[model samples]
Target: MTVSKEQIAAFYSTDTLAGDRMAGIDGLRHTGIATFMRCPHRTALKDVDIGILGVPYDGGLTTRTGARHGPREVRNQSSLIRRINVATGARPFEAARIADLGDVAFTEVFSPATALPEIEAHVRAITQGGVLPLLVGGDHSISYPSLRAVTENGAKPCALIHVDSHTDTWPVFQGSKFHHGSPFRLAVEDGLIDPKRTVQIGIRGGQNITDGLDYSRDSGMRVMMIEEFDDVGWKQAAAVAREVVGNEPVYLSFDIDALDPVFAPGTGTPEPGGITMREAQRFLRELQGLEFVGGDIVEVSPPFDSAGVTALNAATLLFEMLCLMTD
Candidate 1:
């Protein structure tokens, strides 16, 4: 029997234009409040594999204060995301129980001591529920507290894959020790990450001093500079990373400033010569089979973002992390 053209067209029809009851193909992308990839927003973390948490305090930023707005803007712009990884044939939403837990609240004015503890508690609950925290950051400092939450529960310190332009391993900046520049240093001090298993990739630009790089080396992290990264290429870099972080629970922290200013200009500390966004994507995709316990994409200062490129870079990087997690 031949199927009528009207019968085939009926499969695509929506019963109403109210946009309330539609699901599957009849649904619209921008029709509702934006969550991560339009996943359902749930207050509870029960039975979830991946939980998206946004940290909205940028008190730790040394240069610009706009990263506090990163969460809101990233969420607003993520309405454009769909659930599949087209390159790798990964269906992240299908592979895991994912939900957006919304943003963590902080004091009106930013305070690291106050906000860090709050962020830790929020992530602790997610980890307690056996959910992997896919955090969006207020700044790179947020990762330190976040690491505290995930590892503070008597779990062995995990391996870290830190992608950034700066080492962020300084013991302290000036007199203060709680800024974004000092997260991993504090993490190392707290024994929250095994520096032996840690690998920091794509570090570039000049610092006033080389103390941070020296510290990272002395602490046993594999620091791959931009020149070294380009010479070895993504495959060898990824291979070295995989070997260093082998079989351990891994926390992937991506700083948007790791990309050059041209591709991702909205970050607070962007360097001139860095990886391209596509290179970053391929580099991330190359490590698909690792054990990614929790991860974050940080320093997406939306106020500095022109053409929405930085936030978009962040959102897309979040997708890469999501794809890794699901893998």
Candidate 2:
């Protein structure tokens, strides 16, 4: 295909032509009201292939409170994103029936304990309605309920691709098992996630207890701690991830804490040495062909974020995941 100056000119001129399939009537990427990737903001999930849902409940945050604001900031920052994947040639919005389904509704928003079932119900509706959700964070705790919805309603337990600095497999936290530190553990116990088939990447930092670490090892999940990740590198680590998840329907859960403080400083629990944003993007891109039933980017505490660094990185990662979802 030869490049045409006329078509290129028209793309940036004013609006779009009738046959402009690339962006359709969405207008300029930076001009429109921002939804996730500027897809139409719709409340109904009917006939939608992918729903960009937001779980803006961070009641489980024992360290910091601002992750409750992640979804809004991510949505705002996503307006700067343009269609088409630079490396993989993926035009996600063009390829899928995607829309911003807005945030998940909860009856009592302040309590993480009360929020689990509501989040699960929201995800259950999305999954049952045949909509794959690309959720933005309230916090990592949302993963448990979301996974529960997927695994319980789908054909079987989901294989997880959890990218975080913490294993989050603790048996309990501060008298609550539903808190951020224990979602994966709860999921594993409830059979919502297949521990043997799961692969947790970018795990680093120290913890106060060995219970979670011990449980992760005993449960037989592939855990690539930061040092091991350094030895093998992200490419090989991604290959190992693919091998673990195999052909199962996978759920990708990313905590901003998985990123080094330099790349994403706004997370509730910041780890010293972790993957850079670029490496994270590259690794996520590597999962392009897998069966992604659902995914999320969590723990972006915009209140603590520096000059859009963390939120922008989160938005970009969401874009990468969106490309894979389209694939």
Candidate 3:
């Protein structure tokens, strides 16, 4: 579908912070308030189909702490994004009523225990409004709460399409069960997702123990390590993901660490021998027709990023994900 002139005008004019500097598509990409591809910022979800939200809390980190800055850097890099997808000609802006809902407010940024509830509440509000949420996260830990919110307190379980280096199914770390490495496990325990219907891709790297790995296998999740991904190829992998999820309500969670450190070194836990950016794109594109209730791109640490490449890649992938929803 063509992006109407009215849509372009509304999008460019939506960010009032720029104050007349941006009036059309001719406006500078770098000069506006960075709101997820320069989309209009709206707190109220009236008539909104998709809400791009930022969860900027990283208190659940087990190691690196820089992912708290992920959302802002991603937004800045997302300014370079245009409205159309060159690969599939998907015009998300025209296909969906999308807006940048801005970042989730945290009253206790330093406490994951308290802050996580805030994440749940915020996302719950979005879903309750009948809007599909596309969240930009602070870390993988945010997924636990996000799943709870998206599934309506686990009353409705969804299939999962998880792309990450680690299974993130480990038990408590340092007496903390809410760390980034355990969100999926926590989600499963709470019945937020169907483990048999979940597909975890691009899992590689050695671990301190086999608990998370064993848990993922024992729980009946389709764990495709990087080796299997290499053997079966992305197309086949995409096929498995599609077959497993079927037509169920699905949530796609992409941890930047799923990409090789060379492609995404800005993550807190960078794993080598992961998938390439091209492979990631193709895999996501293959997931076009699935019913996605919500999705997130997490673990983008701008401080560790070299020349903002990671954030740029994340922004591009975010666009790809948005295209999937549009499809």
Candidate 4:
């Protein structure tokens, strides 16, 4: 095939209003400074130079190592999908003002004990301004604080839709009550989330033997195992989710380990039999019409990743969630 000059010119064009800024079909406008304030190292790596924010805090990891570096790795490989509005023909930024909002600020490095409160404060400021927060990395524990902030301003408890490989409802781990494995339990116990309106999808791992299953059931949370998911399919699952959540505000929390290790190996916890990338996409796309308050993509450990595949997948999933919210 021969290249055409006209096509080349269209692809290489710059924006006049943006003045020396790169232009794309999506017409995305970068605004706000919340992300840069979260983590300077990650902000510089992703948003400052590359026009993206990659957060890499993994202190909440319970099973594996190096999830703290997830943001950096995911951003490095996220360039694969540079073109915007490629899926739904709707520009996300145009629909609603969006920004990276960076990673949660950790008071003490690798100290889940101190990080939760800090994350709550950061997200509260973002939501207060009416800007939709798109958070990356750290771990599933990060969502607990984010949820607390979202509902802080007199908002009632919202439905929670968690896509993960583990239930993450353990009462406590070691001597710490704030581990990644126990965020949901803390949230529900604290009245930040409604367990009756909550659903945990794609849970299939050995941790079930260690009280994960028991805790989820006792807490009144709906658990949709991966084996059952294979039997019923995502469309039916989405219908069930809609039925449970109704018209209330909702939060979508995605842990990369919810996906099969082959699809997302660079996570704190890797399970063999998990949701495929396609199934995950189908599940997320089905939430198009729901009233989503906020969302997060967590647990991307860059050290274990080969060629940044896991981070790229995480970033793409974040983009898809954004599309669902804005579309």
lDDT of each: 0.84, 0.85, 0.91, 0.71
CA error at residue 223 for candidate 3, angstroms: 0.2
For residues 1-327, write the lDDT of model 4, one tens digit per residue.
Answer: 487998778756833221113223322323312222111233222222112234455667767778777765554454344445465675554554444435555656556666677777777766665555666767778778878888883356889898898888887667877878887888887787888888999988886456878878787888999998889998988878888788889988899998899989888888899888888887887888898888888888887876677887887787778677877
Candidate 1, lDDT over the whole model: 0.84
Per-residue lDDT of 67-177 in model 2, one digit per residue for the tens? Answer: 989988998887777777788899888898888888887888767667888998998898889999878988889998898888874347889999999999987668878
Which segments of model 4 are wrong by more than 4 Å? Answer: 1-20, 23-55, 82-87, 153-155, 208-210
Find the number of clashing residue pairs for candidate 2.
0
Where is model 4 poorest over a 10-residue stretch in terms of lDDT? 31-40
* Per-candidate clash tally: 0, 0, 0, 8
- What RMSD, rounded to one decimal, does every model reach? 4.6, 5.0, 4.2, 6.3
**Tens digits of lDDT, candidate 1, 9-58:** 77458443221222223257766666666666776777678999988878
Best of the candidates, lDDT: 3
- RMSD versus native structure for model 2: 5.0
Worst 10-residue stretch by lDDT in candidate 1?
17-26
The regions of model 3 sitting more than 4 angstroms off are 1-26
Candidate 1 vs candidate 4, lDDT winner: 1
After superposition, the stretches of candidate 1 with alpha carbons farther than 4 Å from their true spots are 1-27, 107-109, 153-155
* Better structure of 1 and 3 per TM-score: 3
